[model samples]
Target: MPLPKESHYTLADVLSWEEPDRVELIDGAPVMMAPPSRAHQEILTELTRQLANYLEGKQCRVYPAPFAVRLFERPGDRPEDVRTLVEPDISVVCDRDKLDEVGCKGAPDLIIEILSPSSLRHDRLTKYNLYQRAGVREYWIVDPSARSIQSFVLESGHYTAKDLGTPGDVLKVHVLDGCFIDLSKVFPEAGV
Candidate 1:
């Protein structure tokens, strides 16, 4: 389907509405996502724990899903011209000013989206373009079924992906300098 006209609901209108289980405004359309499966939630939790552990007391702050990060319209655009609004499975924010009671009001430093059977295309394609256009430094798509993590680093307005499948692979996020994740521990029961 084609995108809606940019005259859709404004952020204030969206915020004033009753919250849904998982509602996001993407390119002027409200995309309702189903609740993630047990496995998806498990992986997200584990990843959040690891990120928190690594970023503890550091300048960067990590957040779990249901945290909306809004991509505001440009200077000449209307308030209703929200480029995208998504709640990533996990996100990191190094900038303090963006943090708010509702959620991060701007692009996050890093976004981690765990793939589910129902959201494969959105996670890999729709969201991929959205984050890249918003200038997100890094984005990760973790596929539990494949037991793999695909890390994408935004370089000059595009994203370059790195596929880390096995436990032996050193999981490194380019934007998170010096941060290292041991894939072995991330997917300990990969063969199962």
Candidate 2:
């Protein structure tokens, strides 16, 4: 079920939600998220592990989902006033200052959202625009069914299609400097 259209929710409201279901806040409205499939979980786990390994001893840190990402449009916005909050499948934060006890307070350097049936539209369009506007340096849309990945790099405040690759190809992270992921490892043929 979708969140009510008449109601406007905030970051604080979403955090206070007692329901076990996961949700994201977009434009001050709560958007319910569907449970991920086994394939999705596998890809997420592999990507997280690979990224965590690459970022070890580095300034940047990676986090998996169920993590909060507060998207405040303006400076000095209080937590209660901030409206947008999302949990990308994987988030890489290069700025240590954004790290809080809860989660990231600002946009992450890189965000990877593994596409699921319910999230295709939200991740490709709504969250795409939101992340671009919020200044996310890189965004990745991983398609488990297709066994492919599409990466977008932020240029001049807009996300540009940087790379699209299948299982045999390798994808590089522009924001992570020299880090890259082997597509075969990310989308194993035997798994999905």
lDDT of all the models against the reference? 0.79, 0.87
lDDT of 1 by residue, 28-125 (tens): 66777889898888788878888899899899999998898885544454445664678899989998888878677778999999988889999999
- Can you give the TM-score per candidate against the true fold? 0.86, 0.92
Best by the lDDT measure = 2
Best TM-score among the predictions, by candidate number: 2
For residues 1-192, write the lDDT of model 2, one tens digit per residue: 334445888876655656636888787777888788988999999999999999999999999998889866455777779788898999999999898887898899999999988889999999899899999999999988888999999999999999998988989999988898999888777835
Clashing residue pairs in candidate 1 (N, C-alpha, C atoms within 3 angstroms): none
Find the 10 residues in a row with the least total lDDT in model 1: 1-10
Candidate 1 regions with alpha-carbon error over 4 angstroms? 1-7, 73-83, 190-192
Output the TM-score of candidate 2. 0.92
Which portions of model 2 show Cα errors greater than 4 Å?
1-6, 73-75
